[model samples]
Target: MAEVDVGKPLPAITSEAKPFWEAAAQNKLVMQRCRDCQAYVWTPRPACYECGSERLEWQELSGKGQVYSFTVIRQVVGRAASMAFEKEIPYVIAWIDLDEGPRMISNVVGCPVEDVKLGMTVSVVFEQQSPEVWLPKFKPLVS
Candidate 1:
């Protein structure tokens, strides 16, 4: 199944990825945690990214992290080019190292693109791109 149109291509819902997307639709950030190694699995693989264990369970995240890396998207290309995104030029895309040890590739919103920096503290904000998809974004965590 597919989510509502967010003016961009939605992710293809696979059997393995269904749980992750389902939690997002409910405005929650979740990842697969390996039961054997106790490691969080990203990318929704069938096995743990750490110990290659198949015993995995869905776990919610605290939504706190630091900007491990970032880039200012001055332009969009390929499937990313859309009218909705055109108005969001010069956005900040970043790799956020979550407090739970997973790094998420997401956009840094609610701040100027130029203000985004490496090591910046951030917290999650769910953007409901469509009714069935709440895209996880981050913003600078205010002290």
Candidate 2:
């Protein structure tokens, strides 16, 4: 696979999400957990999705999941946002359901697009785009 170039858009590091990204840079997957209801809040929100509590803590998770859904992007949409993937055309983007019960959208790497199947088990692999940014991608788990 060709290397994706620099200048691709990256997520803004806010105070609420800094820890999550920092952990990724260190090759660890972390998520926000609600202290009140024991719920794993996704997307790193300021308040818990289940209990509406401001008490949330960062917890590392086993980056393993199954593909809940997926699509093969055969073409780039010809927009600035999609330009980042111009060189990576015909890639598999998937919604993965982690073992911890939260879903994350990521690219399915290290395999052919046609091989990606629903409910296929996957494991996380970090791709460091820059010095501080590490994007979490997944690949099919070896049996």
- Which numbered prediction scores highest in lDDT against the true structure? 2
Residue 10 error, candidate 1, Å: 1.1
Clashing pairs in 1: none
In angstroms, what RMSD does candidate 2 have relative to the true structure? 3.1
For candidate 1, lDDT tens digit of each residue in 1-143? Answer: 45556676667778998888889877788999999999998889899978888999999998899999998989888756756677789898899999999998999999998889899999998887766567889999999
Residue 137 local lDDT, model 2 = 97
Relative to the true structure, how large is the alpha-carbon lDDT of every model?
Answer: 0.88, 0.90
Candidate 2, residue 95: how far the Cα is off, in Å:
0.6
**Candidate 1, residue 112: CA error in Å?**
0.7
